[model samples]
Target: MTQEDPEIQILLDQAEELYSSLLRGETTLADATCSEILIKLETAIEKKKHELKQTSKTSQLC
Candidate 1:
């Protein structure tokens, strides 16, 4: 894995934790709805996955 892979994994793990917290009713944000939060989390996860894929491709080219 590239150096960035671990960082991306960390972010993904964090997002998963936040998701679990939301499901458990443990997260509170005054200005955002749960659906909004989930959408954002999904976006972040997709972005990280894309980044990881790109990183892997670049590493393969080296």
Candidate 2:
């Protein structure tokens, strides 16, 4: 597997923690931050994957 970008890793870790907390009933509706974090994490992962894919294509063309 490809190594994860540091920023992506951090976001993933944070999102995971938040999700787990929600699952355990530790977070309330007042704590709506997890949804935001999940959205950010999804966007970041997609951006990183797209960047890597483009880089790979460029390398292949060279």
Candidate 3:
């Protein structure tokens, strides 16, 4: 199986922790809904993946 990118993995881990905190009623960002957090995380992961792909292509061209 392919390994996950470290940066993306970190983001996922952080998101999970935040979600867990929300479930436990310990989160300070009360205004942010779980779905909103998830959407932001997903967007960040996609951006990171795109950056990695661009970097790889640039390196290959060198």
Task: Score every model by TM-score.
Answer: 0.48, 0.70, 0.53
Best by lDDT: 2
Q: What are the candidates' C-alpha RMSDs?
A: 5.6, 2.9, 5.2
Decoy 2 TM-score against native? 0.70
Model 1 TM-score, 2 decimals: 0.48
lDDT of 1 by residue, 1-62 (tens): 32545654555566677767767778755322455545655666688788879989999999
Model 2, span 1-62: residue lDDT tens: 12557777777788778878878998875584647787887888788779989999999999
Model 1 Cα RMSD, Å? 5.6
- Backbone clash numbers for all candidates listed: 0, 0, 0
| Regions of candidate 1 where Cα sits further than 4 Å from its true position | 1-34
- Model 2: lDDT equals 0.77
What are the per-residue Cα lDDT tens digits for candidate 3 across 1-62? 01456655666677788878877888766544545556767887778778889999999999
lDDT (0-100) at residue 5 of candidate 2?
70
